[model samples]
Target: MAKPQKRYVCQACGSVATRWQGQCADCGEWNTLVEEAGATVTPFQAKHNLQGGGRTFQLVGLDAEIALPERMGSGIAELDRALGGGFVEGSATLIGGDPGIGKSTLLLQAAARMALAGASVAYVSGEEAADQVRLRARRLGLGNAPVQLAAATSTRDILTTLGQGTPPALLVIDSIQTMHSDLIEGAPGTVSQVRASAQELIRFAKERGTAVVLVGHVTKDGSIAGPRVLEHMVDTVLSFEGERSHQYRILRAIKNRFGGTDEIGVFAMETSGLSEVANPSALFLTHRDEGMTGATVFPALEGTRPVLVEVQALVVRLASGATPRRAVVGWDSGRLAMILAVLEARCGLSFSTCEVYLNIAGGYRVQDPAADLAVASALVSALAERAVPADAIVFGEIALSGEVRPVAHAALRLKEAAKLGFARALAPVATAGEGGMTIDSFKTLGSLTDHLLMR
Candidate 1:
């Protein structure tokens, strides 16, 4: 008899390997390899599923069948817009967040809205009892009586029950971490179990044409828990993020095949439910106190929305021998070090003696390189002991040559800034702003040194 196939997989990025190694060659993490029974399905398998022997030379440019009745409303207007107007039939959405970050609440709201919109919705809670979900639903003040809730952790029984239901219904599994399958012997949240469970869920959703919303948990490292393959298998992936002390939550898409990924939806938690924030720009603005150094506004774009957020910096004499500790909450730590190096070398600033710390308030994080200009300004302002002009917003990236590089959507950033009543903006020469404000362009940090240093 032929021997059964065996291979190893990386737990972080899901790259397969035939040999067991101490470190992953893909993601470069240590001890992440696990033995698997069979080889992973390649993208070629997907192509073969459609190609059928690769002999077709038929007509091209075929239009997609846009079905009207299959569309379902998510009840939240901004959320619906982020989903390309509404949920498409047979699409899968993976909602992820940290504990107590309102992942369950958001889905409960969605299920209630779908049922009220005339679509039969079934919400299966693997993490909570049916009574617990009912209590939370009542706390959210949901009065939509059409929705049904079931408590089940077994994936096989859950899929069987879904088969008995009528077609054209929405199914929600809250969440994937607590879900289990008899096919996998390990615990539910293990790397192997998660991969297997997610595969089954995806297959069920695809064959049944049921829109599946899977709630996912995030690891302590702040990434979605489970194999990375789970993310690539979904049709859309969203993050529900916010500071627990604050009542606001932001729903942002990290990946979407059907719609623009940059779109974001903001919500204000209330006694009733999640209320949409009509103006997110105003939410980030603070009540100004005079002469606060190291605080500057940088117009940043999230999806298409332009938000002017305050970039804060603190540079103080080091109290410990750890070499000027670097701490950042929402921005990249490596980028912070790069910006500091630019200040020390190109800008001729003295940062060796001081410890630098950067933070994005309200637990908000940004990955846009456009934040570079704001970070530079914040550091310079703190070093010079003068605040940046409150009316002026910053934009651009700091290069090793100290040049200011342009970022995309500069016009939108300035347009929102103008509507918010900002007057002067220090933007890169690469981007000239729209009307109603003066957009000054800079070539390098050396050119803007006088303005930032003297305030």
Candidate 2:
């Protein structure tokens, strides 16, 4: 018999090492490495396994007939939208978010709604007691929902209880980090433990045709707290994002094997619980004063939905020899630097001696490159003390050479903007706006700057 080797795994990132180190080399977290026990490797085992003793399985052709996976609607339209229509039977979904950001509330709401709609739903919480969950459900006006609830941290006990009965249509694990598996030697939340617990639950789902929804805890950086493989093991990954202070929450699909990625469902935290926001643009857009200098509205597209958001900028001239600070919120800082460079080099606008602040209103983050034109418009409007027309929306990409570039779904963006009562658009040249809105097209950054200055 050969002695088993001691393996160390990083708790922050699932990297393995032969020995412990002060800091993890992969994720650079200090004191995160812990030892785990594994089976010993024997020299003769490698030589003996050249051929397999497994039973043969049939292989199917690419043209084989198949049926689309059936879906189970959660009875909540917003949750179903984030889930790409509805939850498919036997699928595993992982949802992660910051603490106290309404993860439990949303899941409880879904579970209650599904139960009320006559689906067999089981909600197991490792983080809360059954009575606590019941109290919350009652507070959410779901006191009469017939959903089955339990408080268990042991993976074996939870699986065994569910195995004895007819499998439920849905099973919700309140959080994966708190789940413990006796098959794994490490404690819960460890790399080995999370991987093992999730694997077992996913296997149960597959064998029993139960749609499993696992709530995950996010790290300080907002990524799910577990082995990265946990995300890959699931059929869908949903990110719940919102500030605790804000009333709005966004459920964004990061990966969906069955549907389109980047699809988002919007909800607002209300006294009654999480209510669907039918018009997401209303949450992100504030009442703009007429002749406001530093604000421009940009139509942002997420998956197939178009939402309008406000881009705000403020520029202040600095005294001589003072360091000018650049600040940005809800948008990329590097892109801001690039836009400033383009404004100075290609458009002859000087910002080297001025402090600049840029913000996306409503704490809504913008990742669309099309917002480049909008940000530039707001910056120019701020610097020149001129207001971008309140009724006009701006969206386009800016090239390094200062040319304004057209973005995708220009027609779709215009349609949404027109429906919101916008009367005009400042877009790239050749963008077709056939929606009865006036289009003021620009070719270059200099021309856009000239348009703002002249106005």
What TM-score number comes out for model 2?
A: 0.89
TM-score of each: 0.81, 0.89
Best by lDDT: 2
Best by TM-score: 2
Q: Cα lDDT of all candidates, in order?
A: 0.83, 0.94
Clashing residue pairs in all predictions, respectively, total 1, 0
Instruction: Give the per-residue Cα lDDT of candidate 1 at 29.
Output: 100
Candidate 1 lDDT over residue span 45-115, tens digit each? 63467646567677656586665535678888768756766777788889888798777888888889888
lDDT for predicted candidate 2 compared with the true structure: 0.94
* Candidate 1: regions farther than 4 A off: 1-70, 183-187, 317-323
lDDT of 1: 0.83
Pairs of residues at least 3 apart in sequence or in different chains that clash in candidate 2: none
Tens-place lDDT per residue, model 2, 264-327, is 9999998889999888887788898888998999999999999999999999999999999999
